[model samples]
Target: MDRVLSADEIRWIHDFLELKDITYYDVQVEIVDHLASLIEAKWAAGSRQSFEVLFFEVFKDFGDHQWRQLLGAKQKGVWRQVVRNGVSIFLNFFTWPLVAYTFLSFLLIYTFLLAVPNAVNYLQESMYLWGFIVLVTWGYVIYRRPAKRAFLAYDGFVTFLGIDLYLVGWILPDFFAIFSERFSATPNGMLGLAAFYSLLVLVILTFSILMRIKGVQQFYKTYPQLLITQ
Candidate 1:
Protein backbone atom coordinates (compact mmCIF):
# COMPACT_ATOMS: atom_id res chain seq x y z
CA MET A 1 0.00 0.00 0.00
CA ASP A 2 1.20 3.53 -0.79
CA ARG A 3 2.00 5.70 2.25
CA VAL A 4 1.06 9.37 2.54
CA LEU A 5 3.96 11.83 3.02
CA SER A 6 4.35 12.61 6.69
CA ALA A 7 5.10 16.02 8.21
CA ASP A 8 8.73 15.00 8.53
CA GLU A 9 8.90 14.13 4.83
CA ILE A 10 7.47 17.53 3.87
CA ARG A 11 10.05 19.25 6.08
CA TRP A 12 12.79 17.13 4.53
CA ILE A 13 11.78 18.34 1.07
CA HIS A 14 11.90 21.95 2.16
CA ASP A 15 15.32 21.54 3.72
CA PHE A 16 16.64 19.71 0.70
CA LEU A 17 15.52 22.48 -1.63
CA GLU A 18 17.16 25.05 0.60
CA LEU A 19 20.44 23.17 0.72
CA LYS A 20 20.46 22.78 -3.07
CA ASP A 21 20.90 26.59 -3.40
CA ILE A 22 19.65 26.53 -6.95
CA THR A 23 16.41 28.44 -6.48
CA TYR A 24 15.51 31.55 -4.52
CA TYR A 25 13.99 30.87 -1.09
CA ASP A 26 10.48 31.82 -2.09
CA VAL A 27 10.67 29.90 -5.35
CA GLN A 28 12.03 26.81 -3.67
CA VAL A 29 9.30 26.90 -1.08
CA GLU A 30 6.67 27.26 -3.78
CA ILE A 31 8.13 24.39 -5.77
CA VAL A 32 8.25 22.11 -2.74
CA ASP A 33 4.67 22.96 -1.76
CA HIS A 34 3.48 22.41 -5.31
CA LEU A 35 5.16 19.01 -5.44
CA ALA A 36 3.71 18.05 -2.07
CA SER A 37 0.18 18.97 -3.21
CA LEU A 38 0.58 17.03 -6.45
CA ILE A 39 1.85 14.00 -4.57
CA GLU A 40 -1.01 14.26 -2.05
CA ALA A 41 -3.53 14.42 -4.88
CA LYS A 42 -1.99 11.34 -6.47
CA TRP A 43 -2.23 9.43 -3.22
CA ALA A 44 -5.85 10.57 -2.79
CA ALA A 45 -6.73 8.92 -6.13
CA GLY A 46 -6.47 5.48 -4.51
CA SER A 47 -3.26 4.63 -6.38
CA ARG A 48 -1.01 2.04 -4.76
CA GLN A 49 2.37 3.78 -4.74
CA SER A 50 5.44 4.31 -2.60
CA PHE A 51 6.47 7.82 -1.47
CA GLU A 52 9.62 7.30 -3.53
CA VAL A 53 7.59 6.62 -6.66
CA LEU A 54 5.35 9.64 -6.09
CA PHE A 55 8.36 11.84 -5.36
CA PHE A 56 10.08 10.74 -8.54
CA GLU A 57 7.00 11.32 -10.67
CA VAL A 58 6.30 14.75 -9.22
CA PHE A 59 9.98 15.73 -9.32
CA LYS A 60 10.34 14.73 -12.95
CA ASP A 61 7.73 17.38 -13.73
CA PHE A 62 9.56 20.00 -11.63
CA GLY A 63 13.20 19.13 -11.09
CA ASP A 64 16.58 20.07 -12.53
CA HIS A 65 15.28 21.25 -15.90
CA GLN A 66 12.74 23.61 -14.38
CA TRP A 67 15.25 24.77 -11.79
CA ARG A 68 17.81 25.47 -14.48
CA GLN A 69 15.35 27.60 -16.41
CA LEU A 70 14.43 29.50 -13.28
CA LEU A 71 18.06 30.07 -12.37
CA GLY A 72 18.88 31.28 -15.89
CA ALA A 73 16.05 33.77 -15.76
CA LYS A 74 17.16 34.97 -12.34
CA GLN A 75 20.75 35.36 -13.53
CA LYS A 76 19.69 37.33 -16.58
CA GLY A 77 17.66 39.68 -14.44
CA VAL A 78 20.57 40.17 -12.02
CA TRP A 79 23.02 40.86 -14.86
CA ARG A 80 20.67 43.41 -16.41
CA GLN A 81 20.45 45.24 -13.11
CA VAL A 82 24.21 45.08 -12.66
CA VAL A 83 24.88 46.57 -16.09
CA ARG A 84 22.40 49.38 -15.51
CA ASN A 85 24.01 50.31 -12.20
CA GLY A 86 27.56 49.80 -13.41
CA VAL A 87 27.19 52.35 -16.22
CA SER A 88 26.14 55.13 -13.89
CA ILE A 89 28.79 54.24 -11.29
CA PHE A 90 31.62 54.19 -13.83
CA LEU A 91 30.65 57.56 -15.24
CA ASN A 92 30.48 59.28 -11.87
CA PHE A 93 33.29 57.64 -9.95
CA PHE A 94 35.96 56.00 -12.09
CA THR A 95 36.18 57.12 -15.71
CA TRP A 96 37.56 60.64 -15.74
CA PRO A 97 40.02 60.30 -12.86
CA LEU A 98 41.46 57.13 -14.37
CA VAL A 99 41.81 58.74 -17.80
CA ALA A 100 43.38 61.94 -16.47
CA TYR A 101 45.83 60.14 -14.22
CA THR A 102 46.91 57.79 -16.99
CA PHE A 103 47.45 60.57 -19.49
CA LEU A 104 49.32 62.85 -17.10
CA SER A 105 51.54 60.12 -15.68
CA PHE A 106 52.45 59.02 -19.17
CA LEU A 107 53.17 62.55 -20.26
CA LEU A 108 55.45 63.23 -17.28
CA ILE A 109 57.39 59.98 -17.74
CA TYR A 110 57.90 60.68 -21.42
CA THR A 111 59.05 64.20 -20.78
CA PHE A 112 61.52 63.03 -18.13
CA LEU A 113 62.97 60.37 -20.44
CA LEU A 114 63.44 62.84 -23.33
CA ALA A 115 64.96 65.45 -21.07
CA VAL A 116 67.65 63.20 -19.56
CA PRO A 117 69.09 60.78 -22.09
CA ASN A 118 72.33 59.78 -20.26
CA ALA A 119 70.67 58.34 -17.10
CA VAL A 120 68.80 55.71 -19.13
CA ASN A 121 71.20 52.79 -18.51
CA TYR A 122 71.18 52.72 -14.68
CA LEU A 123 67.44 53.47 -14.60
CA GLN A 124 66.88 50.40 -16.78
CA GLU A 125 68.75 48.10 -14.37
CA SER A 126 66.96 49.52 -11.32
CA MET A 127 63.63 48.95 -13.02
CA TYR A 128 64.47 45.31 -13.74
CA LEU A 129 65.23 44.72 -10.04
CA TRP A 130 61.98 46.41 -9.06
CA GLY A 131 60.07 44.30 -11.59
CA PHE A 132 61.40 41.09 -10.06
CA ILE A 133 60.47 42.21 -6.56
CA VAL A 134 56.93 43.13 -7.62
CA LEU A 135 56.41 39.82 -9.42
CA VAL A 136 57.54 37.82 -6.39
CA THR A 137 55.46 39.85 -3.93
CA TRP A 138 52.35 39.65 -6.10
CA GLY A 139 52.71 35.90 -6.51
CA TYR A 140 52.99 35.47 -2.75
CA VAL A 141 49.89 37.57 -2.02
CA ILE A 142 47.77 35.69 -4.57
CA TYR A 143 48.86 32.29 -3.33
CA ARG A 144 47.99 33.28 0.22
CA ARG A 145 44.39 34.15 -0.74
CA PRO A 146 43.19 31.47 -3.11
CA ALA A 147 39.66 31.60 -1.71
CA LYS A 148 39.03 35.14 -2.90
CA ARG A 149 39.61 33.97 -6.44
CA ALA A 150 38.05 36.83 -8.40
CA PHE A 151 39.73 39.53 -6.36
CA LEU A 152 42.98 37.63 -6.56
CA ALA A 153 42.69 37.57 -10.33
CA TYR A 154 42.13 41.31 -10.41
CA ASP A 155 45.07 41.82 -8.09
CA GLY A 156 47.23 39.72 -10.34
CA PHE A 157 46.36 41.95 -13.31
CA VAL A 158 47.23 45.06 -11.33
CA THR A 159 50.46 43.45 -10.24
CA PHE A 160 51.31 42.83 -13.86
CA LEU A 161 50.75 46.49 -14.60
CA GLY A 162 53.19 47.33 -11.81
CA ILE A 163 55.69 45.03 -13.43
CA ASP A 164 55.07 46.82 -16.73
CA LEU A 165 55.89 50.13 -15.11
CA TYR A 166 59.09 48.70 -13.75
CA LEU A 167 59.98 47.28 -17.13
CA VAL A 168 59.39 50.59 -18.88
CA GLY A 169 61.47 52.42 -16.31
CA TRP A 170 64.24 49.87 -16.90
CA ILE A 171 64.11 49.92 -20.69
CA LEU A 172 63.82 53.67 -21.25
CA PRO A 173 67.36 54.31 -19.96
CA ASP A 174 68.92 51.47 -21.96
CA PHE A 175 67.20 52.71 -25.11
CA PHE A 176 68.59 56.15 -24.42
CA ALA A 177 72.09 54.67 -23.92
CA ILE A 178 71.95 52.87 -27.28
CA PHE A 179 70.72 56.05 -28.94
CA SER A 180 73.47 58.18 -27.35
CA GLU A 181 76.19 55.67 -28.32
CA ARG A 182 74.88 55.41 -31.88
CA PHE A 183 73.54 58.84 -32.77
CA SER A 184 74.50 61.70 -30.43
CA ALA A 185 76.10 62.90 -27.16
CA THR A 186 74.38 61.67 -23.97
CA PRO A 187 72.72 64.59 -22.09
CA ASN A 188 73.48 63.64 -18.45
CA GLY A 189 76.70 61.66 -17.86
CA MET A 190 77.56 59.03 -15.18
CA LEU A 191 76.83 60.92 -11.90
CA GLY A 192 73.69 62.49 -13.32
CA LEU A 193 72.67 59.11 -14.71
CA ALA A 194 73.01 57.50 -11.25
CA ALA A 195 70.75 60.15 -9.69
CA PHE A 196 68.23 59.72 -12.50
CA TYR A 197 68.11 55.94 -12.05
CA SER A 198 67.82 56.36 -8.27
CA LEU A 199 64.86 58.63 -8.81
CA LEU A 200 63.31 56.05 -11.12
CA VAL A 201 63.78 53.39 -8.45
CA LEU A 202 62.15 55.63 -5.85
CA VAL A 203 59.22 56.33 -8.15
CA ILE A 204 58.75 52.63 -8.92
CA LEU A 205 58.90 51.75 -5.24
CA THR A 206 56.35 54.41 -4.36
CA PHE A 207 54.06 53.25 -7.16
CA SER A 208 54.31 49.63 -6.06
CA ILE A 209 53.44 50.55 -2.50
CA LEU A 210 50.49 52.62 -3.66
CA MET A 211 49.24 49.79 -5.84
CA ARG A 212 49.54 47.29 -2.98
CA ILE A 213 47.52 49.59 -0.73
CA LYS A 214 44.86 50.04 -3.38
CA GLY A 215 44.71 46.30 -4.02
CA VAL A 216 44.24 45.57 -0.34
CA GLN A 217 41.49 48.18 -0.09
CA GLN A 218 39.75 46.80 -3.17
CA PHE A 219 40.04 43.23 -1.92
CA TYR A 220 38.45 44.18 1.36
CA LYS A 221 35.63 45.98 -0.42
CA THR A 222 35.11 43.10 -2.82
CA TYR A 223 35.21 40.40 -0.12
CA PRO A 224 34.15 42.02 3.08
CA GLN A 225 34.07 38.60 4.70
CA LEU A 226 37.85 38.66 4.52
CA LEU A 227 37.84 41.50 7.01
CA ILE A 228 36.41 39.20 9.68
CA THR A 229 39.70 37.34 9.89
CA GLN A 230 41.67 40.56 10.06
Candidate 2:
Protein backbone atom coordinates (compact mmCIF):
# COMPACT_ATOMS: atom_id res chain seq x y z
CA MET A 1 0.00 0.00 0.00
CA ASP A 2 1.20 3.47 -0.79
CA ARG A 3 1.91 5.77 2.15
CA VAL A 4 -0.48 8.71 2.23
CA LEU A 5 -0.49 11.73 4.49
CA SER A 6 -2.78 11.40 7.46
CA ALA A 7 -5.46 14.02 8.12
CA ASP A 8 -3.35 15.54 10.91
CA GLU A 9 -0.36 15.75 8.64
CA ILE A 10 -2.44 17.55 6.01
CA ARG A 11 -3.68 19.99 8.63
CA TRP A 12 -0.09 20.62 9.59
CA ILE A 13 0.69 21.38 5.98
CA HIS A 14 -2.09 23.92 5.90
CA ASP A 15 -0.71 25.53 9.01
CA PHE A 16 2.76 25.67 7.56
CA LEU A 17 1.45 27.28 4.40
CA GLU A 18 -0.43 29.92 6.37
CA LEU A 19 2.70 30.60 8.35
CA LYS A 20 4.55 31.10 5.12
CA ASP A 21 1.92 33.74 4.14
CA ILE A 22 0.36 31.63 1.39
CA THR A 23 -3.03 32.08 3.01
CA TYR A 24 -5.32 32.31 0.02
CA TYR A 25 -7.22 29.01 -0.17
CA ASP A 26 -7.32 29.05 -3.97
CA VAL A 27 -3.51 29.31 -4.09
CA GLN A 28 -2.76 27.26 -0.97
CA VAL A 29 -4.77 24.28 -2.14
CA GLU A 30 -2.55 23.74 -5.19
CA ILE A 31 0.68 24.04 -3.20
CA VAL A 32 -0.71 21.72 -0.54
CA ASP A 33 -1.50 19.04 -3.10
CA HIS A 34 1.94 19.34 -4.68
CA LEU A 35 3.70 19.22 -1.32
CA ALA A 36 1.60 16.25 -0.25
CA SER A 37 2.58 14.36 -3.38
CA LEU A 38 6.29 15.08 -2.92
CA ILE A 39 6.25 14.06 0.75
CA GLU A 40 4.40 10.83 -0.03
CA ALA A 41 6.86 10.05 -2.80
CA LYS A 42 9.76 10.42 -0.37
CA TRP A 43 8.05 8.14 2.14
CA ALA A 44 7.46 5.56 -0.56
CA ALA A 45 11.12 5.73 -1.60
CA GLY A 46 12.19 4.27 1.76
CA SER A 47 13.39 7.60 3.16
CA ARG A 48 13.43 7.42 6.98
CA GLN A 49 13.11 11.18 7.35
CA SER A 50 10.28 12.69 9.41
CA PHE A 51 7.51 14.66 7.66
CA GLU A 52 9.18 17.90 8.75
CA VAL A 53 12.48 16.83 7.22
CA LEU A 54 10.85 15.78 3.98
CA PHE A 55 8.83 19.00 3.84
CA PHE A 56 11.92 21.19 4.30
CA GLU A 57 13.85 19.13 1.77
CA VAL A 58 11.14 19.69 -0.82
CA PHE A 59 10.49 23.33 0.14
CA LYS A 60 14.20 24.00 -0.24
CA ASP A 61 13.61 23.73 -3.95
CA PHE A 62 11.64 26.96 -3.58
CA GLY A 63 14.04 29.34 -1.86
CA ASP A 64 12.64 32.57 -0.40
CA HIS A 65 13.10 34.49 -3.66
CA GLN A 66 11.82 31.56 -5.70
CA TRP A 67 8.75 31.33 -3.45
CA ARG A 68 8.00 35.03 -3.96
CA GLN A 69 8.38 34.58 -7.69
CA LEU A 70 6.01 31.62 -7.58
CA LEU A 71 3.49 33.67 -5.62
CA GLY A 72 3.67 36.51 -8.14
CA ALA A 73 3.18 34.03 -11.00
CA LYS A 74 0.16 32.49 -9.29
CA GLN A 75 -1.37 35.94 -8.73
CA LYS A 76 -0.88 36.88 -12.38
CA GLY A 77 -2.56 33.64 -13.44
CA VAL A 78 -5.56 34.35 -11.22
CA TRP A 79 -5.90 37.87 -12.62
CA ARG A 80 -5.72 36.47 -16.14
CA GLN A 81 -8.66 34.23 -15.32
CA VAL A 82 -10.50 37.31 -14.08
CA VAL A 83 -9.94 39.08 -17.40
CA ARG A 84 -11.04 35.98 -19.36
CA ASN A 85 -14.23 35.66 -17.35
CA GLY A 86 -15.00 39.37 -17.82
CA VAL A 87 -14.51 39.10 -21.58
CA SER A 88 -16.73 36.03 -21.78
CA ILE A 89 -19.48 37.69 -19.79
CA PHE A 90 -19.25 40.85 -21.90
CA LEU A 91 -19.50 38.81 -25.11
CA ASN A 92 -22.57 36.89 -23.94
CA PHE A 93 -24.64 40.10 -24.00
CA PHE A 94 -24.23 40.22 -27.79
CA THR A 95 -25.44 36.67 -28.50
CA TRP A 96 -28.76 34.83 -28.81
CA PRO A 97 -31.88 36.09 -26.99
CA LEU A 98 -29.72 38.39 -24.91
CA VAL A 99 -28.88 40.27 -28.08
CA ALA A 100 -32.53 41.07 -28.54
CA TYR A 101 -32.72 42.62 -25.09
CA THR A 102 -29.53 44.52 -25.78
CA PHE A 103 -30.94 46.11 -28.92
CA LEU A 104 -34.23 46.85 -27.21
CA SER A 105 -32.33 48.58 -24.45
CA PHE A 106 -30.44 50.74 -26.93
CA LEU A 107 -33.61 51.68 -28.78
CA LEU A 108 -35.38 52.56 -25.56
CA ILE A 109 -32.52 54.82 -24.50
CA TYR A 110 -32.47 56.48 -27.90
CA THR A 111 -36.19 57.09 -27.76
CA PHE A 112 -35.97 58.43 -24.23
CA LEU A 113 -33.31 60.95 -25.25
CA LEU A 114 -35.49 62.14 -28.13
CA ALA A 115 -38.44 62.62 -25.79
CA VAL A 116 -36.73 64.46 -22.89
CA PRO A 117 -35.10 67.87 -23.23
CA ASN A 118 -32.68 67.31 -20.34
CA ALA A 119 -32.12 63.59 -20.84
CA VAL A 120 -28.41 64.05 -21.61
CA ASN A 121 -27.83 65.68 -18.24
CA TYR A 122 -29.83 62.87 -16.66
CA LEU A 123 -27.69 60.33 -18.45
CA GLN A 124 -24.47 61.89 -17.20
CA GLU A 125 -25.83 61.95 -13.66
CA SER A 126 -26.88 58.36 -13.98
CA MET A 127 -23.39 57.34 -15.07
CA TYR A 128 -21.95 58.96 -11.97
CA LEU A 129 -24.63 57.25 -9.88
CA TRP A 130 -23.77 53.90 -11.38
CA GLY A 131 -20.12 54.54 -10.55
CA PHE A 132 -21.08 55.13 -6.94
CA ILE A 133 -23.15 51.97 -7.02
CA VAL A 134 -20.16 49.98 -8.23
CA LEU A 135 -18.08 51.29 -5.37
CA VAL A 136 -20.81 50.45 -2.88
CA THR A 137 -21.18 46.98 -4.29
CA TRP A 138 -17.44 46.38 -4.00
CA GLY A 139 -17.45 47.68 -0.45
CA TYR A 140 -20.41 45.51 0.47
CA VAL A 141 -18.66 42.44 -0.77
CA ILE A 142 -15.60 43.24 1.32
CA TYR A 143 -17.68 43.96 4.40
CA ARG A 144 -20.14 41.08 4.15
CA ARG A 145 -17.83 38.28 3.09
CA PRO A 146 -14.39 38.94 4.38
CA ALA A 147 -13.62 35.24 4.14
CA LYS A 148 -14.02 35.33 0.38
CA ARG A 149 -10.98 37.63 0.34
CA ALA A 150 -8.94 34.58 1.29
CA PHE A 151 -9.48 33.28 -2.24
CA LEU A 152 -7.12 34.42 -4.95
CA ALA A 153 -9.87 34.26 -7.56
CA TYR A 154 -12.19 36.36 -5.46
CA ASP A 155 -9.43 38.85 -4.72
CA GLY A 156 -8.59 39.16 -8.39
CA PHE A 157 -12.23 39.70 -9.30
CA VAL A 158 -12.59 42.41 -6.69
CA THR A 159 -9.48 44.16 -7.93
CA PHE A 160 -10.85 43.99 -11.46
CA LEU A 161 -14.05 45.63 -10.26
CA GLY A 162 -12.03 48.46 -8.70
CA ILE A 163 -10.32 49.11 -12.01
CA ASP A 164 -13.75 49.05 -13.63
CA LEU A 165 -14.95 51.64 -11.17
CA TYR A 166 -12.29 54.05 -12.38
CA LEU A 167 -13.02 53.27 -16.02
CA VAL A 168 -16.79 53.53 -15.85
CA GLY A 169 -16.97 56.39 -13.39
CA TRP A 170 -14.21 58.59 -14.73
CA ILE A 171 -12.94 57.53 -18.15
CA LEU A 172 -16.28 56.62 -19.68
CA PRO A 173 -17.97 59.85 -18.70
CA ASP A 174 -15.10 61.97 -19.99
CA PHE A 175 -15.13 60.07 -23.27
CA PHE A 176 -18.88 60.41 -23.55
CA ALA A 177 -18.64 64.17 -23.02
CA ILE A 178 -15.99 64.59 -25.69
CA PHE A 179 -17.81 62.31 -28.09
CA SER A 180 -21.11 64.09 -27.64
CA GLU A 181 -19.46 67.47 -28.16
CA ARG A 182 -17.85 66.38 -31.43
CA PHE A 183 -21.18 65.15 -32.82
CA SER A 184 -23.55 67.77 -31.35
CA ALA A 185 -23.41 69.91 -34.56
CA THR A 186 -24.84 67.09 -36.69
CA PRO A 187 -28.54 66.11 -36.92
CA ASN A 188 -29.79 63.74 -34.21
CA GLY A 189 -26.15 63.43 -33.11
CA MET A 190 -26.50 64.23 -29.42
CA LEU A 191 -29.38 61.80 -29.15
CA GLY A 192 -27.37 59.09 -30.85
CA LEU A 193 -24.36 59.72 -28.63
CA ALA A 194 -26.42 59.70 -25.45
CA ALA A 195 -28.13 56.51 -26.52
CA PHE A 196 -24.79 54.83 -27.23
CA TYR A 197 -23.40 55.91 -23.89
CA SER A 198 -26.49 54.68 -22.13
CA LEU A 199 -26.27 51.29 -23.74
CA LEU A 200 -22.58 51.09 -22.90
CA VAL A 201 -23.20 51.98 -19.27
CA LEU A 202 -25.92 49.35 -19.12
CA VAL A 203 -23.63 46.70 -20.56
CA ILE A 204 -20.76 47.56 -18.23
CA LEU A 205 -22.94 47.64 -15.11
CA THR A 206 -24.45 44.31 -16.08
CA PHE A 207 -21.01 42.87 -16.61
CA SER A 208 -19.86 44.03 -13.19
CA ILE A 209 -22.93 42.59 -11.47
CA LEU A 210 -22.65 39.27 -13.23
CA MET A 211 -18.93 39.04 -12.57
CA ARG A 212 -19.26 39.61 -8.85
CA ILE A 213 -22.27 37.31 -8.46
CA LYS A 214 -20.78 34.51 -10.50
CA GLY A 215 -17.39 34.74 -8.86
CA VAL A 216 -18.89 34.71 -5.37
CA GLN A 217 -21.30 31.87 -6.17
CA GLN A 218 -18.58 29.70 -7.67
CA PHE A 219 -16.31 30.20 -4.68
CA TYR A 220 -19.10 29.40 -2.22
CA LYS A 221 -20.16 26.38 -4.22
CA THR A 222 -16.63 25.01 -4.15
CA TYR A 223 -16.00 25.83 -0.50
CA PRO A 224 -19.27 26.07 1.35
CA GLN A 225 -17.51 26.03 4.66
CA LEU A 226 -16.23 29.54 4.05
CA LEU A 227 -19.82 30.75 3.93
CA ILE A 228 -20.81 28.91 7.11
CA THR A 229 -18.04 30.50 9.14
CA GLN A 230 -17.59 33.99 7.59
Off by over 4 Å in 2: 1-12, 143-149, 181-186, 223-230
Model 1 stretches with alpha carbons more than 4 Å out: 1-124, 152-176, 179-201, 226-230
| Candidate models: Cα lDDT each | 0.55, 0.74
- For candidate 2, the lDDT comes to 0.74
TM-scores, all models, native as reference: 0.35, 0.76
lDDT of 1 by residue, 23-104 (tens): 3433454466788888888988886787778888888877677876766665565445444443444354336765565455
* Pairs in steric clash, model 2: none
Among the numbered candidates, top TM-score falls to 2
